[model samples]
Target chain A: MMRAVILAAPSVDALDNPALSALLGLIVITLIMTLGVMFATWYERKAVARMQQRLGPMRVGPWGLLQPIADTLKLVSKEGVRPASADRIAWDLSLAAIFVPAFLVLVAIPFTADWFVSPMDLSLLYILAVGGLSFIGFLLAGWGSDNKYALLGGMRAAAQLISYEIPMILSMLAVVMVVGSADVYRIILYQDVVPLIVWQPLAFIIFLTATIAELERQPFDIPTGESEVAGGVFIEYSGIRWSLFQLTGYVNMYAYSLLGAFVFLGGWEWPFGTDIGWGYQLLLTMVKMALFIVFFLWVRTSFPRLRVDQLMSYAWKVLLPFALAQIFLNGLVLVYDLPDVVLLATSGGGALALCWLVYSVVRVKPRQPLRMVGNVPATAPGSVSG
Target chain B: MPFEALLENYLAVFLATIVGTILVATALIGTRILAPYSKDRAKVTSYECGMVPIGRTRAQIHVRYYLFAILFLIFDVEAIFLFPWAVNVAQASHSAFWAMVLFIGILAAGLGYAWRKGVLQWNR
Candidate 1:
């Protein structure tokens, strides 16, 4: 009954008729994702432009609404080529490989209370597992291109992702521990009284950082670091092939924002304590997602990229410990039936303390350079290489 | 019926994924066919900062990254163990919570070993 359609009878019918619902949901979500990509591209440009005190995309259409279309057309018209030595199959498949997982996660996302495409009970797990597979596409892209830079990018991306995944899941586990279900809708329901962000700001921040790393966004985008590795995994791609990667990135950006909104900002639930219509419910969810998108854009424009090693350490030493603290503290709070303030104080204070401890420990050492075991010449008189 | 309903949900997800993939592929193919394609040896050759490409592209990878991968597999499996416990948190006993505590502690110990071994250090 919770799945009843909002605003009008049309959506309700779509929701009730299981077969028809799938078809309609596909169409709707596809349109939404495409439009989101278009809009996000423009939004990112404009936001970055304003940050630098300049106008962006003013000529094409009203507020440059047509910019993305022009960009897409340009991409399609450009020639996509493969290197002679490239793995043709993997090179060709990489675009779709990157694309498919993002869209699948989209299908699992709850757009609104009644407008969900597929409200799987295990939505969190499904989204995490499926979305996490995009790194494979990056790996394939790197390996397929037969370029050293691409391989480096791909490998760095793999490392970044592997390191970040631990903290990301650990942070999400805190929420799961509290809610007791991986179902996104159920998590939302548990937030009826209060959103998890208010309850666990530490986890929220950890997740935010982890997600940035996961998406390979600015400050964590070593995989596609343009200046260093020449577009990293995407070094060999051109034309529509390249655009597909861009599309996947933008769409997943929106998807992650949607996930963040659902998990932490209370999904379609109105924070203002108002019972709105279904159409408004959909709109509210969108608005929340849009806010998160802006936050992502703002952070992207503001921060510089972390060095590969620093990035890994940040995950393993800093965010990982905080995430673990979130779980341990939550367990204590649950078993002891401690007051809610205890949860807030311990998580917040614990995060600060852990940050300082990690920074102090890591900073003092100021990491040394790496050399292979055989590379070091033995200076000792008894050594073989002396 | 509900189980079928559940399956129907996943069916839609798979379908959506297919549709999205097809849409992208169609665009790529359309571009591939329509775009001007006049290639030379230079155009198709591998790129490396505009030089005659050196040796092999596939370099031997450092064991550091592989170490992270090995650790990821271990932790990811351990993380999966939480779902069952989390799915029924309402009736979780003191013992149930403590089990999680012990597990996390063991994981932390492993992490400590990694840290002490300089596995967590990036530049070194």
Candidate 2:
């Protein structure tokens, strides 16, 4: 079935040609990303449940296998609500605006060496540009609701996303400079002898950190921190609209994982060998992506959210400089023809510098509690007590 | 496939975006039709934990976000220039490498200036 579609897709007429294949690919990927979310939700619940010593969703199907499906049905059947003061057009437009960009991200992602939608020359740039657009929907949703908290949430999310994007791009820039291509496949191919992770551990760490922030995962998820400003930009959405946001979040998580795997983890090629067939490479890439996803989940459930102010400072103060320095180091290596050992040493030195930089920037004097115990009137009715 | 066939691949992306949007719209509109919507005055108003809402959303947004937009534009354009240069690196001379170094040095200096000015502090 798949073979026929791939081979026959080009023979069709111009309008029908790409559209047919696109339609088929979209449906397949949509289903895959949807299923990825479902499995991830179950995996998260089961993992966290076990870690916390509790059974999670045991009654729904065998071992809670059907829970995501059940949740989807419930969401589909639930009434969709709109805020009274909401801007109707933006409220509706926000759903597509957020999700379409996320879906477009899949366009540039390499599922396998052979299987991918668009292997464009600027695929890397394409992904980043489209990924950046997702937050705008949140901004619109926040504003459209005419809710104060929503606006705050939206702005906070905007600031976090925009700040983090610099480090993320800069980290990718390091790899792009070393490999000498912005093409995803070309980058992956450059890792045949040794993965980029082994080549540039510091960039790997920076990229992962920035990616977590980009996805708004825990330790960086203050935008939707329930303890503070309610659900933030997504507060007003309900029913299917809310589900789209949820779906976008999960899809983005998987997409970034795939990107990390491709760029740093040797992509489809295994670390041990480069002669592996497409099948093995595909499996290897998926395994790497899965490992990344699991790591993200662990970090997410384990960490507490950072203050919004701290998040901004971390991006600008720590990550941005580290990224810039890494770029300089990588450029120097390229110009001077440095050996792998030197690059490795540079990675080590870069890591130490990053740690020191963060420590210095985040250090602060401990706060003392208010000296005055319970509220006593400054001037007691008739006489003032000093 | 020919190299020219490469450009056609993006058509798939454009189509996929439309399909994905339709899929979301299907779920949203599906629920909108299948599920009952209650549009009572109180139900439709913004959520505030059973209390009345105060103030407007417009006045609350600070100018820092606008700064973020400008900063993002600068960096995005920088990345855009880096892409083509990175792609053509193999064909370029040692001079090409120095030229890029100059470009990125200026970019970093600009970011450093912004940091020194405390333009990146979000909450302040």
Candidate 3:
């Protein structure tokens, strides 16, 4: 019975024709990802709201489960007002520029043991390369909007995204170095005895930090900070167009979460040792991915947005050096045929050093309390104080 | 056959791109059909928190952004070069490892120079 399901799974050659299989696999994964992102928005709101001791989205459905659907309906019916000053073509085309790459990254992601839309030799590299293309969309939105806020936001988004991309790629490169394969499945298979995170804890930590920054969640969400450039590159987009930007954001979040799960958490091959069918493999993938998403939401709720200067410095000065160091360490071990235990020691020490560096920088002197000046008179007479 | 397999892999991505284009087009058309449109001058005016817009939108941005872009290009290209080397490191000879270290060291020196020049400083 299990053999039948495994045989029927959507691997590279599930159907008679490869084209047909590709089409069918894309549709299934697309639908699942869309629903997953929808559920994610509702979950993020509820989770973050609960963290702040507030009940969120109580109305749309049971526990506001249908809120994302309602949001889609509302956004779909809202007017897409283009600014008269905007570049009409680029403004409209930027949506496709951003949204398509988010979906393209899903092409190589394996949800189960044999259920990927495409299995490439360098699927890991493909995902990263495709994922980087969305920065162009942000830049286009900023340039085309003809709004000051949007322009400011767009440049910020591009800078932040590109700055974070280096460390993220390098961290993944460290993993690839260890496994000696950039293929996602092979990387997972190598983790049969122990997950890569145990061997490369520094890379794991750097990847997590960089992923948060890449996803533009709080602390790193300087581009879209409500207190600053309004909605940033999305300041001019309204209605379905605006909602598409938001949808891309959530989709990217899910993509990164899934990537992190497969890369560091041993994907479905850990503990269970890859003998289980696709059903359990899929379950393991979802559980690990959910852990990543929840951590993102928790960080989003708990952290304050970093200053723009601090954000850039953190990427260049802090994360980049550590990431390069991770690569060097991995190379050292692999070159000399060193024992795996050496990796745990060197990387674990590197992780500790990274933590210390961040902690030392973050531990600044507290600001003095505000000293209010006494005015001639209070605006409200009874509310006046000395 | 191997080449065909490679094309099949990319075929999935191509199909996804087509689907995405169709999805965006459908959303645009669906909004045109379902959403309301009113011709108000105020609505079309470039949004600036309900105030009369003062200057052109594409004014001079900070020069720092340009510097960062150039830096990003250098590092990004370096990273691309590292990927294939990284995957092949285990099978390669010890000399291969030293070669990478030299390559990275030179780049790191460049980075150090940039750092000293205050290129990484945002506010300064």
Candidate 4:
């Protein structure tokens, strides 16, 4: 069954027609993933609306199934505007920069054992390196736009992403430590009995939170905060260029979801010692990916946006310390020959405890009313202030 | 596969592609420069949304942006170093992990100092 699925993919036998096969595979995957992204958008709107007691996209296509498609068409047909002050070449390059790496990142992700295009030993590193490249694209988009808002958005995004990357990489290190290898396939294979989530719970939580921030998802989505920065780095983009940014965003969402599946949920692995066929394995993978996407949307709706300072502090102060502690604990577990389940439970509990402790410590206290020098009032009676 | 072999295969391909793209871009720019020799009064004039040229093509920008950029570079460069160190952590001695812990400890201290100094605060 696995062999058949592998053989069914056009890319599998494309060693004979390398270029043509690669192009075809690219098109197919792009279309499928695009559809997945479109559905994900609709799903998010509906889910969030339900959570908030409202209806979303009901008028589009049967509960807004076609809304994303409609939105895409509208965006494509819209007029593209270039500012007089903008750098045209960099502006165009920014779109390609943001998107190309996202496309390549998908290549390294394995949907199932045989379903992977080519299993490389360095898949995890490849993903991380490619993921980091998107920041260049984002930074260019902001700087090249020559708009204050765009520049601010881009800078904020750069700072946030660069800051959070520390805890994010550290969290992944915890996983790599337990798995004993950086290879995605080997990691999955190690999870044949129990997933890494069992042993590296803290790492899983930190990784997921940081990944969402890396993807610029909300509560950490100050980069594109509409109210504060007017759509952030994307404010200057229009027409197909804007669509490219949107497309990259959706692709990143899918890629992050797939990453979460591979690391924590145990890629293509069935729970409870059951051995399913290839078809069921593929289905299970999709289900896991969908569950992750829902998790992304759920968190977005449940939390308000974090202030920029708060976001940075959370990454550096909160997540970083806990990631360090978790790594230390994992080392202890390995040295002591503890059961995998025990290690997983204790690591996860430790992470949560550390987070709560950090949260309490970092909780901001209300500032005392500003004191005035001498007898002067802090503010005049009719004066307006922030 | 051995580590050396894997590195040779992937890194060689990656570097070759990057070099190829650079060569192609350079060739395109050279062709445009060597092929054209036309200059008109209109060509010398600045184009600003089809309006008359403004005072200057460049102006002073806010120093805050440069400050942020510098900070970003420092942290980004630090993050890059962590990647390889992380990959080799398993093979290294126990001292390596502790060294990393201390390294991160120093960086975290910097972050804390910046927070106290209001560098990370946005509203101000």
Best by lDDT: 3
lDDT of 3 by residue, A1-386 (tens): 64465467746345856667888888887788789878988999999999999999999889999999999899999999998888988898999999999999998898888788888888999999999899899989999999999999999999999999999999999999999999998999999989999999999999999899888889799989888998798878899999889889999998999899999999999979888999999899999999999999888888888889989988898889898998999899999999999999999999999999878666654544445458443243323111
* Residue A37, model 1, lDDT: 88
The sequence of per-residue lDDT tens digits that candidate 1 reaches over residues A272-296 is 4336667887787889888887888
If ranked by lDDT, best first, what sequence of candidates would result? 3, 1, 2, 4
For A149-252, candidate 4 gives per-residue lDDT tens digits of: 67778878887777677677777777877777778877777777778777787888888888889989988899999889888778877655676677778888
TM, every model: 0.89, 0.89, 0.93, 0.77
Would you list the clashing residue pairs of candidate 3? none
lDDT of 2 by residue, A15-104 (tens): 345566566667788878889898988888888787678988898999999999998888888887788778998888888888899989
User: Candidate 2 or 4, higher lDDT?
Assistant: 2
Deviation from truth (RMSD, Å), model 4:
7.7
Q: What proportion of the real contacts between chains A and B does each prediction keep?
A: 0.74, 0.71, 0.82, 0.08
Docking quality category of candidate 4 according to DockQ thresholds: incorrect
**Better-scoring candidate (DockQ), 3 or 4:** 3
Distance from true location, Cα of B58 in model 1, Å: 1.1
Best by TM-score: 3
DockQ of each: 0.65, 0.63, 0.82, 0.13
Task: Show where candidate 3 strays beyond 4 Å.
Answer: A1-14, A364-386
